[model samples]
Target: MFLEREEYAILRSHVHADSVDLVDALAATGLRWSEMAALPPRDLTLHGSRPMLRVQRAWKRIDGGKALGAPKTKRSRRTLVLSPYLVQPFKRNCAGKQPNDFVFTAPEGGAWDSGGFYHAWTRAVSTMRVGRPRSPPRPVTASPNDRVSTTSVTRPQSHDLSHTHASWLIAKKVPLPGIQARLGHESITTTVDRYGHPLAMLDDEIIEAIEWSMNPMAA
Candidate 1:
């Protein structure tokens, strides 16, 4: 499930202010929540000509709880260039922290736990689509003639941002191999299987590009 740019903007608004950066970063970088949650100040290079985020570690499930460990796959350990728009947010998260300090934290402090974030995400999406939560279904006890109206909306998992990221890249015509590498897919086939088709909305853009390529007037 991919969200258009403006739709993403609305979803971002529904998340907590402290989590806004994390949400934006996820949409921007395609980092898995575990990789993102485990990011440290040292992992980000927010200055210089090429600002980037280094994904080396992730929070992995352990017997009792979880621990910082290698990512699920070696390919998942990769570097992602940051768009200029994310520079300030990344830098802001990096400031006043030691190299090992967590970059994205909960409002009360400490690294974010996945389970804890679910409630916030649920609430945000519940109201995000209709600008309010859906109405409950009518109880069986209600009269047969009673009206039962409810709003139906998609509650996309936060991980959907990863797919959304790939779609955005596809829209921009970023090469499949490049996107595969950026997304750290273990195999190019995974990337192809997931996002091979260009979005229908891009047909016009594709035509325009083809025309420009055939003409010397393209600048």
Candidate 2:
């Protein structure tokens, strides 16, 4: 369900101009939907040696309206490195905004609701035609006697972009601990449990490593 680069590009091209920055930031940093919606201007640090985003609060849906509160977990309150692609967009989004202003806001300059964001996402994705099947990848099969292990691979909703981000990192061979830190997972086990599938293209390398370990003198 993760978007290929071309798919991502197509989707981005179709997103409303005002929302492009917000969507890019979500894909780039894997921020939770709520966290992204509640992001404040003061949380952005673009001039330091390393640009970063401090995830602090999230928009919560209460009885009759939305409310702001601390992130769902203590570990979720962390800083994420900002990719170069995200820097200018974020800067533009913050221009002339007060410190308390949400970095990404609705057309009326208010916290975005899940429904509104989903509608926009649906519109953008509807126009996309360059990617693989949008359904989740099939589970890798093991021996008949072994218990089936399924990895999280679906992007059924926009929120699944977080899983896509983690999958991309895992495919790049980034360590689980590092991915956990970046995604703000409470534990490394959670990161691994959800994204531990070895990418199909990496199978050769995995086999070679195993062979080398078992027969170091053969070559």
TM-score of each: 0.81, 0.81
Tens-digit per-residue lDDT, 74-152, candidate 2: 9999998887778898998889999999888887667777888898888886776544433343457745576543543
Q: Which ten residues in a row have the lowest lDDT in candidate 1?
A: 126-135
- Report lDDT (Cα) of residue 51, candidate 2: 93
Q: lDDT tens digits, residues 1-219, model 1? A: 777788898888888777788889999999999999999999889889999889999999999889999988989999999999999998898889999989988878898989877777787887677233356777979998988777654467889899989999988878878999899999999997887564565678879999999999887
- Model 1 TM-score, all chains together: 0.81
